[model samples]
Target: MKIQKSFAQSVGTLYLVPTPIGNLEDMTFRAVKTLQTVDLIASEDTRNTQKLLNHFEVKVPQKSLHEHNYNERIPELLDFLRDGKSIAQVSDAGMPSISDPGHELVVACIEADIPVVALPGATAGMTALIASGLLPQPFYFYGFLQRKKSSQKKELEDLRNQTATLIFYESPHRVKETLKNVAEVFGNREVVICRELTKLYEEYLRGTAEELIEYLSEHSLKGECCLLVSGATEIAEEEVFEGTLKEQVEALISEGQTSKEAIKSVAKRHNLKKQDVYKEYHEL
Candidate 1:
């Protein structure tokens, strides 16, 4: 009998490798092995990935794969796959497909019948959510919000009635604005704000949306911020308005507004005291 190998038994290889969210311990053993053995690794930046590869002692050749050059880079990465060589994709942090450019290459791999495996590792949103101490029942991952004020407000409006919890990734500078906008569209709903996760001085603050806005307004934030907003309170189908404090507050908080701004909006809408809204929101 002759030894036989079918074409199906041979195939191209692609890998979605996740990097550390913060502490290096978050890296997985499988991720290490795959990066160690892959023919070439496509990283978001050669310098950033080089630091990671240096730390882990992974010496695979890595080139940049980011938004600027994605149009040109995908075909280059795919060529290795077409040649039956394996390639591992990694981001500066977290899973490659998420909020990162590796998804395009992964999609190409899928279209070409390449074997693409995602080795699970760090993801900031899930990490923040798990550590947030807030209810995790059902949540929406909003990713990064739009920078424009009106657009950001619209984003929140779109999720106004979603019963799932809302999660978002925000920059240090933009956290205040995003919270303000969220407060307008979603109203004084509970919010958990996390920042500089897994690093020294990592912070997690939980409070109503207005309270969060007040807090951030006073403090000069210096690191990345992740906002987790509690979902809309259930509304009776017969009821014209969701009409809860959270909903009321959410409706008023806009992108560039402050707690004071949100409070004014709520007070005007409900014919209630600004003091009363502030007191309930802050217990002050």
Candidate 2:
């Protein structure tokens, strides 16, 4: 005997709704509909979201879902979907997944074959990135840096030669130290600093690494900051072949430098990834 599937079964959609970064007016029209219609709403913070829903007069039920509980709650959420109940997932602010906790849950929903829809909404990183006046393409988002100076320094060192724009979000207290580290690691690259975005006191500070270091010292910073730094430019191919690798290698090799030693020196001096230099040495 064949069994018939029930049409009354509910299908849940994980909508990554973005809330206002600062101004409540930034919320989109579709976001309002999705929040109001979903069977359940998931948020990073109930208190914060309550104010939003209250403002829009959305009477939907809500569940707490954030970085700490996202993994723990997904299985249960999936079970709710299998029971055929529609649901909506949202972070406390901005898009649900980016720099937020919903990424893992999104992957879980995909694995479970649940339909997911991300409603268009405000995202601080994107807002700051485009307005940052940096080369938007080929950019990287670091979110937040290691708070410790040494660890943060290492992070900057790793990206020292990254040939794209770099972005990071930081609290007011650490913005000064963070920018200083950028200057030390990447040199005098251009920086666009955004603070209290889309608010009455919104400010954008544009300057070089050296200038920002000076400016921040004198001014009182009031809001969370997003930083954009331009990346290193790729040097022309002709610049490298000008110094014969064999000649360079032979000089180091003659000075008791092993193949590894010779490769490291060349790689560091030329700002090429170490693996590329090793591959060329292996080919030789």
TM-score per prediction, in order, is 0.79, 0.79
Candidate 1 positional error at 194, Å? 0.6
The predictions' CA RMSDs to the true structure, in order, are 11.5, 6.4
Q: Give the per-residue Cα lDDT of candidate 1 at 106.
A: 72
| Tens digits of lDDT, candidate 2, 1-284 | 32323233246566678899999999999989888988898888988899999999999988898878877788988898767777878777788877777888878877777777777879888899898888998898888899999999989988887888998988888998999999887888899889998999999999898898899889879888888898887532333444566567667888999988888898877878768877776664
lDDT (0 to 1) per candidate: 0.81, 0.83
Clashing residue pairs found in predicted model 2: 10-84
Say which candidate scores most in lDDT. 2
Q: Number of backbone collisions per candidate, in order? A: 12, 1
